[model samples]
Target: MSPGDEHDFRGMDQGGRGDDPYSTLGGTRQTRTRLPDGDAGHPHARRPVRNSRSLITITGVVVLLIAAIAFANRGGGNDDTASPTTKNPGAAGSAPTAPTGTKPVQGKNGTIASGFAHDEQGAQSAAANYAVALGSAEMFIAESRQSIIQATHDPAVAQKLQDDLDTAYSPAFYKNVGLNDDGSTPTGLTFVSRTVPVGTKVVKMEKDAATVEVWCTGLVGLAGQGSTKPVTETWFTISQELRWVGDDWKISSSSQAEGPTPVNGDNRASTADEMAAAVDVYGGFTYAR
Candidate 1:
């Protein structure tokens, strides 16, 4: 298939429109007449001023109300022990999508993140990071692909997974994606393959094993002057079956699927130089759940 054609490597390494409320409503024109200053019918005619005592009473009532409101809104007691719902009042009963202030993994096996906690959150983090590794440009190369598989997969399954990936990312496949036989870009081109995790979910969790789905958006293709396979974005979700091995989570198996895609926006596409520069300047993240 051509580079533009949709292709999938099975079990391998893979906004809202707002309506204008006034649009349908017709604009109305109104006529207004200014009455004489002293006329009782005048909408802007002056009224009798309140007495000093009545003004005082009104001012006191206003002050009291303000004080009452302030007192009622002044949350008391220790903040650390407050429930998520209590702390974020209107978000009650809703799952939190914000970060929980937990630090990302501090350990690394070479460049890959390792030493995940033995829990659901850890599984999710591992899955996300592994997805990034599996979908990287480095995975197109033989040596790095094997290294990544070994680092991310369980010991028992690593060799087989590496073999599968090696076959999947063959020299022919590299050429189809506009790379050299050894998975290197041509002299004047920059090959971009990067996977960014949008979110992660744990499908199933147990004491020692977990299933996680990592939603990702990736860029893949060659970027530079006179390139036919221009860099383009793609969305995919990778499901990882993880097992707790040693002290970290390791992928036992992995598979990929097309995304829960979004409607494309009308933004102008960037040039090859711009995309290449962006990839070089901006660094990838270490995700934490």
Candidate 2:
């Protein structure tokens, strides 16, 4: 709802401190250290300090354990009011409740999927799917981009939106993303831009209009030998305002903001060739709530 530039979903940009003072004795100071059980009067009496630090560490651990227990008890269901579950990953709970086996969508619209249900759940699904389509690398090309914009956006605004998107994905932008001036991948490289939805939430809902926020993890960049822009993952949240149009939810407008990012995993980084192979072999999904 703010005037923060609607199409500001820029790609992730690739991009610490210090030590001591008052060393009068310089590096040769004769320091007296005390044992953990030493008397307090002794110049080396560090025993009490060690004990205090240990106590503080133990206290911190206990507090965190108790907080974890409380958060787990709260469960993962959508909280009526704002809570840590809405923003923080692994804040609490086990696996999410199982899906109800309901169908995700009724059919496809020109190459894009569509025909979502007409409820909050439907709005969430539409947002997630539209995010995938809009975030795909295919949307860089003129034909595919126009198709995607027409398929996902409201018809009343699709033409203007398509023109805006065309300008946004200019030749300069394509070059920046390691694509050719015409949005084609360079020789022997595969440009990857895919959005995978982690979850969706209904931020607002009404009879014929709704707003849904979809949290997504995306992979973007080029993959292959001698590629400077190797694919990297980024986390972002997309908020879509949807309208029930022609019996299905269509995006009236949308905006994206960075993060809600979690700490990186300990997995080993794969080789560029391996990443290229994986991207070639693996396929993306049509995300749904």
Candidate 3:
């Protein structure tokens, strides 16, 4: 099968669409409106007070309300479009020549008001990168795991995630990847845990929250010659529901399922030495909108 066939492979990546957990969250309702000004203020205007202090305070309040109204109307419905420059600092720093590759035909993370008018794009970029961080190799180390959980997941769900993954990647898990019974690597071999995303979809998006499904295939193995644990590739899917909290996006919950994987390629398998070399040679990417 073509790589594209396996792109949506497995129950993990192509599990139809999961239910939208926040289908019930309320958002703003846009109704027809006549222009605001000149429509007439309250019939009785305040005594036309000329107190300079009062004038300054009233002006400040009006400016704030205008700002709030602008925020609520952002990320316009359905054909919702937001400025990409605003949400992600990583993207902001990226050279414009960098490619975005393909675009998904479906889904959008709902948009919410970012008080900062320039934050829409940055928020989306952060959400995507945060997803990568959540699915990265660093999550395996205890310290990195804690840091990832704290940085990428909602505080409300971090503890539960820490507990669940601890149980999931137990000694048995380590053993499968050629690690010791305690999840440590033997000398001279490098353990690998990588989640390479084929594509990502934001079924529903918002500036403040998003439901993104990441179609991923991963590599897990110990790369070294004459090693009992040979490197292997596994296909699985990882889904993340993220919420913008404080200033960055955090995962609220996530899950994985087995592949819609296709047959392996006919290319010759690389030697352990070559495999180790490749790992060292290749660098990772920072995915974004």
Candidate 4:
């Protein structure tokens, strides 16, 4: 099956406690103690009475202090305290998903992003963007496929990869997927092929090479009335071996596998026209670490 056919198996009671401490420590007993009525000359005669008003004031102060501390520990809405996933909505995984805040590469080879950094982050960014290009609708078209391969693969393998893809996305393949021989949709239909990276991870990194895996969910099929192959979603992970060449990362080789798929939600399925319109309206992203 094509990459797109992957199975979609895809508040503490501080105030009350403070009062308890005082009460449990014989506070009430102490308050109830009364000096002899006539003991004016006693050594403790000058001491002021500890009233309930005093206890209440002290408890209020303690509660306020506890609350202030809890708020401060929460970082007062600081981004540092935010979960990594929250910080970078596109990034997945448990840790190290925080945004580096590095600007996306300014360079582009045709429509593909390039000029990645020399670090692990850059490798991940390159792998993710390359996955997007490889799974794009453009890959079904000859000229665009060549452009994508040239922009994504290492020079040594670009030609071979292009040739292989040309064979794999043959006219028969296009027809099987409900597209024309040249990768165009039939009249009144929209062909959709898009890969969205859910997260990325660096399996291994070195000075000159890196292996990164991009977990992706994609939409692939024709959207229109009477379509045998209606637009459907698939989940897969693309593992890309990258090389830092000429100040950028290029894919040396890559492989894909079925996903860590999610259970289907209970939402109503949209109509063909609705799906087509949504695809047309929502543009893809240039993924980055």
Top candidate, metric lDDT: 4
TM-score of 1: 0.66
Query: Quick one: how many clashes does candidate 1 have?
Result: 0
Q: Among all windows of ten consecutive residues in candidate 4, which has the lowest summed lDDT?
A: 6-15
lDDT of 2 by residue, 120-220 (tens): 66777888898788777787688997888778877876776665555556676566556789988899988777778888877667777776777777776
Give lDDT tens digits, candidate 3, residues 67-132: 222122223222346434223233333334234443311222222112211133343454455545
Cα error, candidate 3, residue 17 (Å): 13
lDDT of 3 at 175: 57
TM-scores of the models, in the order given: 0.66, 0.67, 0.55, 0.67
lDDT of 4 at 116: 86
Candidate 2 lDDT score at position 157: 64
Over 4 Å off, model 4: 1-94
**C-alpha lDDT (0 to 100) for residue 144 of candidate 2:** 91
Worst 10 residues of 1 by lDDT: 21-30
| Worst 10-residue lDDT window, candidate 2 | 16-25
Kindly report which residue stretches of model 3 are placed more than 4 angstroms away from their true locations once superposed: 1-128, 169-173, 259-263
| Backbone clashes counted, model 4 | 3
Model 4, residue 94: C-alpha shift (Å): 4.1
User: What would the TM-score be for candidate 2 when compared with the true structure?
Assistant: 0.67
lDDT by residue for model 1 over 1-289, one digit each (tens)?
1111212222233211112111100101111233335555544434332243322221221122112212222232123443332222223442345765665475999889988878766788898998788667776677887788789877876775555445455577666556788878899878777788888777566677777877777676667888766665555566667789988998775545555466444345777888888888888777777
